[model samples]
Target: MDIKLWQAIIYIVLALIIGAAAGFFIARAWFKNYLKKNPPVNERMIREMMRQMGRTPSEKQVRQVMSSMNQVK
Candidate 1:
């Protein structure tokens, strides 16, 4: 291919890559902020349970609940 064609292709590919990267980062940041502001109610329930029980819930318990919830789909 000619140099101009190759340059145009490369520029298009670079622009796409940069746009995708910017979108991913922006989404990640936004979701993180959203989660912080509104945490999952189930997780909050678990935290409260741990406080009442005077012990932290095991990782297994948390994972089990999360997996079960996911499996409901």
Candidate 2:
């Protein structure tokens, strides 16, 4: 069976839209899973980092660093 020009264009557009939607959801789910496995920074991580840097971090210093990070975001 032969398709008309407009019908072919409609089918192509529909395919593109469907593909884009599927790609978006797949990427989003993968990103969420990746973040779940490798989560963002937290207070404990900050403290450990400071310790590794050879600095004994005080509570106030950690909180200050956290606040600064929050402000940047």
Candidate 3:
């Protein structure tokens, strides 16, 4: 390959690597911020939701629901 071609190829590869790394970090940060703003379903929310549905949730049921939700994640 010509010297200039090799240099161009090297620059492109470096840019791709840097872009990929930057994209990964940006996406990771966005996801964390989204989670902080929206949050996830928790045991207290589940219990409240169940209560609103006119069913009293037991401790064991709440724990089971929380475990199931965690497993999906």
Off-target runs (Cα >4 Å) in candidate 2 are: 1-3
Worst 10 residues of 3 by lDDT: 64-73
State every prediction's TM-score relative to the real structure: 0.57, 0.84, 0.86
Which pairs of residues collide in model 3?
none
For all predictions, the C-alpha RMSD in Å is 6.6, 2.2, 1.6
Clashes of each: 0, 0, 0
The per-model lDDT (C-alpha) reads 0.85, 0.96, 0.96
**Candidate 2's TM-score:** 0.84
lDDT of 2 by residue, 1-73 (tens): 3568889999999999999999999999999999999999999999999999999999999999999999999
**Candidates ranked by TM-score:** 3, 2, 1
lDDT tens per residue, model 1, 17-53: 9999999999999999999998865865776777798
Look at candidate 3 and tell me the lDDT of residue 25.
Answer: 100
Residue 18 of model 1, lDDT score? 100
